[model samples]
Target: MAASKTKKQVRKSQFKLTSEQEADLRKVFDIFSKGGEESGYGTISAEDIKIAFRALGYEPKQEEIRQLISGVDKDGKGLLDFNDYLAIMTKKMTQKDDVEDLQKAFELLDRDRDGKINSGDLQSVAAELGYFTGTMAEDLQEMIDFADKDGDGVVSEREFLKFLKKTTFE
Candidate 1:
């Protein structure tokens, strides 16, 4: 009788990494993997995970690393395989990029570096963009009103972020 062969199932990740990103991740993983250059499939210890995170520009607390490992380490081994490391790193990198982009936008809108977005800031930005007109005060006030959730007459960083999240996500 002929033996039936079963194919290994490959799980698809929701997040996709580019070739350069994948290469960088592999380099980091191999550097810390238990097998080093030999097996290329070994897991890394918790301490190794912390070092790897730093090498990748993350400064997570030890407790945060432990929690992340616990969440992603599928075999309950308290170690990270390449797949787990990739997932965690991908998520962290994406989150950091999002926050950085948001911060840049907020700084541009803040104009005077006062940590808040008021009508003056809006007017300055509008004028820079050639959108300012003689009657733009009412329009700018409307914009501020839309974003000022706490009725504070201005948008703080937290409020601006909340407004963006609401508009973008919903």
Candidate 2:
């Protein structure tokens, strides 16, 4: 009987990394996955990611960590494997697309991946990012009044992008 062989799947990513970036990422991954087997498929849990980020002097919020993991976890397995780490490093090191960056910010703010942001979403994001102040209702209303340009009670991607651009340019 012949043995059946399965090919390892390689996920396609939007951005590519330079050789130097790849080498640097490999080095970082080694630090995170020291006790793992030598096959290079070492994985890091989401919690471990938060610890690593903190160790590197980043005060990352939970939503930020979730966004980072979900954005790069190609297989959607909830844990970041080696390839997923590489995808994240590539995006971080080569983020030249304004729209892509905006979309990433939108995704982080959306929280629920609903393609829109409402008062609740804004409140949730504010709380997660540790920026909440004043009454929740008041903050939500203020944010909506400022960014809900279409007056639809929710901020669509277009409105979100416009809001960001306006704030950035102002």
Candidate 3:
């Protein structure tokens, strides 16, 4: 009998570090991109960040770029890790309509009158948003089951938010 092989799945995340750590990551990234120049290293300017973001497939507006660089250690002493960059990266900075729709989605997901949303809320919201099938409540439950992290019977707000953040790649 031949054994069946399964490929390991690589999970993609928006960030895994703090805002300050993101700066550090950015410094290392920039230096590597600049041929590892150590002496009189040039700062990663707003323009540079903008161009980099574009390369990363995100074309944020000038104001958004300015905001992202506002507190950067302009001397390149501080760096931006993946996590730090995530806060600014996923934001709907340039498009007002997109922000409004995102807000609406947030509102719908926050079920049970709680300020936060869980996986159940996600199922309902997804259904309302027409992202699923079979109009049955059981169907929604099954979808929620797939995304719920804690077996405690509900997906926490943070988990739902994480699911949203991760689903971007799909």
Q: Give every collision pair in model 3.
A: 21-81, 22-79, 22-80, 22-81, 23-79, 23-80, 23-81, 24-79, 24-80
Q: Please name the candidate that would achieve the greatest TM-score relative to the true structure.
A: 1
- Ten residues in sequence with the least summed lDDT for candidate 3: 6-15
Local accuracy of candidate 2 as per-residue lDDT tens digits, 1-170: 12332211111233466688577667766668634648887887666776665543446678867887888776776678777766655544443345567889898888788899888888787788897776777868788778888788889999998887667523
RMSD of each: 8.9, 15.1, 12.8
Error of 2 at 50 (Å): 3.0
Q: What residue pairs clash in candidate 1, if any at all?
A: none
Which lDDT values do the candidates have, in the order given? 0.80, 0.69, 0.53
Model 3: residue 9 alpha-carbon error in angstroms: 23
Q: In model 1, where do residues sit more than 4 Å from their true spots?
A: 1-15, 62-67, 126-170
Q: What TM-score does structure 3 among the candidates reach?
A: 0.34
Q: Estimated TM-score per prediction?
A: 0.66, 0.41, 0.34
lDDT of 3: 0.53
User: Of the candidates numbered 2 and 3, which has the greater TM-score value?
Assistant: 2
Q: Per-residue CA lDDT of candidate 3, range 1-85, in tens?
A: 1233221122212224466745654654464344324552433434466666665556677886666655553555444443344
Q: Candidate 1: TM-score? A: 0.66
Q: What tens-digit string does per-residue lDDT give for candidate 1 at 51-151?
A: 89889888988888777777898778777778888877886776566567777899999988999999999999889999999799998999999999899
lDDT of 3 at 91: 43
